[model samples]
Target: MEREIFPWIGASRGTSILISKKKSFHYTDVIANNSSRYIIVSGIPQHRKITLINIYAPNSGQLVGDPILLGGDMNLVNNPLLDRSSRPLPADAALSTALDELQRLLRVTDVW
Candidate 1:
């Protein structure tokens, strides 16, 4: 029997990033916390490098440099009236502030 291996990062419990065996790149750096996982890959066909982040935020974390893609459960809603149910819960003000700061610093836009 043979076993197939895939490149991955992060703890078993929290946030994680898994690279498919076919498209997995040569990663040079990794930063993982309770709420996020950062992986820096090299020799990305055309681009020199790209950073991939899997984040679950409002908790504290370190920021990564540019040419990156970030996605995860933000634990936030843009318009509670439209996005939430009948009993809408308010997002934590402090967390919202922090997330906003992160977005500004990263200069990235939400895709959806």
Candidate 2:
């Protein structure tokens, strides 16, 4: 698939837009869009439409709604020792807690 850009105007740090696509990922109808900080989409599969949300969430992940695929650059680490670029840094308790909550919220494998 190729990128499509259209006339867009003022919005916040994140925005959601919708586009209709003929087919994608086993779905005959797909709708998707991206913003400065997130991407959101819905696909009609098996006669039902489900959503996937991609975000650059702030500290808390800010998860809402039930989504089939929830994705983002959450800046969280399941294993701090291995996730950093170089030397490991100490984990922030709050971020860890938030990430844990996000994990529980999604209830799925967190691998990319």
Candidate 3:
């Protein structure tokens, strides 16, 4: 099944998750906004819960679980010096700081 969340005004900006029916996982909760979507699912066999988050920008939120994975096009970079070829923008620096704090709070590792 294809799950999509579009902005209230239109579908110009949105995120989608395609789940196969044959998969042994089903979604239990979903939280979405104009720029982000969060889905919690449980594996049928192991009954392990997982939270998946997709984001388009910097948005603060929380999820509780042993393992959580996030995929996004956030404009923020972890290390500007290594990630960027030019000088870091002010806006990006702020967002990067916010992202760092969020990651620390969530105790999640950046796989970038």
Q: What are the lDDT scores of the predictions, listed in order? A: 0.53, 0.54, 0.59
List clash counts for every candidate, in order: 0, 0, 0
Q: Output the worst ten-in-a-row residue range by lDDT, candidate 1.
A: 1-10
Question: Which candidate achieves the best lDDT against the true structure?
Answer: 3
Among all windows of 10 consecutive residues in model 3, the one with the lowest summed lDDT is 36-45
Better of 2 and 3 by lDDT: 3
Off by over 4 Å in 2: 1-67, 91-93
lDDT of 1 by residue, 1-112 (tens): 2221223533453455555555635666666543333333333523467766554433333434424566677777544566566655655555556776888898877776
Error of 3 at 82 (Å): 1.4
Over 4 Å off in model 1, which ranges?
Answer: 1-67, 92-94
Instruction: Return the top candidate by TM-score.
Output: 3
Q: List the residue pairs that clash in candidate 3.
A: none
Sort order, TM-score high to low: 3, 2, 1
The Cα RMSD in angstroms, rounded to one decimal, for candidate 3 relative to the true structure is: 15.1
Q: What is the C-alpha RMSD of each candidate to the true structure, in Å?
A: 14.6, 14.3, 15.1
